[model samples]
Target: MRNSIKSVFAAIVLSIGLFPLAHADDALDASKLYKAGQLNEAIKKIDAVLAQRPKDAQMRFLKGIILTEQNKPAEAITIFSKLTDDYPELPEPYNNLAVLYASNGQYLKASAALEMAIRTNPTYGTAHENLGDVYAKLASQSYDKALQLDSANSTAKLKLNLVKNLIGNTTGGTNPKTNTSNPAPIASIPNTAMVATPPAKVIEPKPVTPTVTKSTAAINEKDNVLDVVESWAKAWSNQNVSKYLAFYAKDFQTPNGESRNTWSEDRRSRIEGKGKINVRIDAPNISIDSNVATVKFKQFYTSDRLSSTSRKTLVLSKQDGKWLIKQERSGN
Candidate 1:
């Protein structure tokens, strides 16, 4: 799997070209050294660039890729992590972070990072595909755990074997530790090109009708709905069961078709059982119609024993002038 990831990234880089040549000489020279497999020289060139422009995101990103090729995953992770912090709007750093995490068998963390990547850029196909691979690895772990607890369970055994076969197919059945392939190339750099255009003839303009805009009340309602959703996440993170439950409407639909009271109790137990927990919502997409609103987002969850990321949707409705959750589901 790691080798496949590296191969795909290398292909992407070659196809897309490297960073925009703002500092054309240095950046181009460094990219040339990297492509030549001269990692030591590449690192020195990148370091020299960083020494002058310490916050150059592109150089730092290149350095991270070089570090990964050098088998310095810890250092690479640091670089990518810092990039994500400083440039949360850039999806590439998050994707690279996920790759490093997966290389280390930290699929949960990888999934979370990938979720952030997708949130940053919904059109990023690479991150989306990488996330699927990470999820497969996580499913493999769950199946293995099930077999450990019930060795006699034929179903679990069958699923475990199937997952293992799937993983083996992608990874060439090679142990990650022994697979000494070069790390995947970083293709996150934005490509820039200059094009010359012919002059256009002057044209007359026509008067246009006014565009319709949302009413102030509608805008405020959307804001309120978002506030409610954020508060719910905060409540879950804080383990405030009452507050979390209060965000739901009296007729809230339970995901598993359970009675509302029963569902609340189950949620309470799970929230309180955790030693620590965090729930974050990223890139929330909301649509409002009449009194109802539907919101979809990447939900990242973490606790002492587990971490995961998933796409979640919530249906909210106006109730007594406040937005409350009416229904919830996972995935689109």
Candidate 2:
């Protein structure tokens, strides 16, 4: 599986004209081990190398990849963020950072990172595919946009198909809309994630439009969010390219002045390391107005494989009558 993905990424990169432009100081040995699928060994080798040269951005980036594959995404995020801060000109760190976002259902952050990645290297197919996924997530968030948006966007269409394929593969034979909606009881979540405080003011809500409950609806919007969040967790648990992304309004900002996209993506990857995961969401607080709603839950995590749980807030809205997450943020 690893080799196949590498081969595909390489071919995709070559097809798009990306040269293997590792910096002079980059740790080639670790890269080779990572390319060979020896993730743990690559990590150790890079750790030794970085121990001697802690400031090497390329080495850090390479180590981040290995750690991510090893289900150490939080560490990966730290490494990648450091690489980007230390060497903002490099595109790979941004792309990898996007990967972390994607794996956590933080699509907006994934999209933003891919944009930066593309700005640095137009030929980076990983960024393109990732951006495609982000667009696909946006489409998922707003079906009307799917129909209204340009059909010339082959990338979005392709990514939609890819997401469908991935969901299909992961969900046995059930339709993605159905499979992801089947919510298991909330299990214990990792204690590592922060819990966000929901709006305390009980703003007088508008009349609730009666809709099918959790057990029904051709597409249970709330259930769908649960499933998507579940799938996002599973994707990270499996180290599936760390492209999980959640949607949030561009206007949504955290108390700390962080955008919903940035805050949510940061915590999502922090807790959902790249391994197995057991999860539980606090009693969900859901509110709807017309086709828009907010699904507030404190996602808890266990320490077994995927450790740490952060409080999670997902803002969901309806586009064409389908519920879509537009924003996410976490508080612990």
Q: What TM-score do all the candidates reach, one by one?
A: 0.53, 0.38
Give the worst 10-residue stretch by lDDT in candidate 2. Answer: 1-10
* Residue-wise C-alpha lDDT for candidate 2, range 127-224, written one tens digit per residue: 67557655655555453345348777676566656655433221121111111122121121111011112223568889997876654663465556
Worst 10 residues of 1 by lDDT: 190-199
TM for candidate 2 is 0.38
Candidate 1 Cα errors over 4 Å, as ranges: 2-22, 169-287, 290-332
Total backbone clashes of model 1?
A: 1
**Local error of candidate 2 at 160, Å?**
9.3
What are the Cα lDDT values of the candidates? 0.71, 0.53
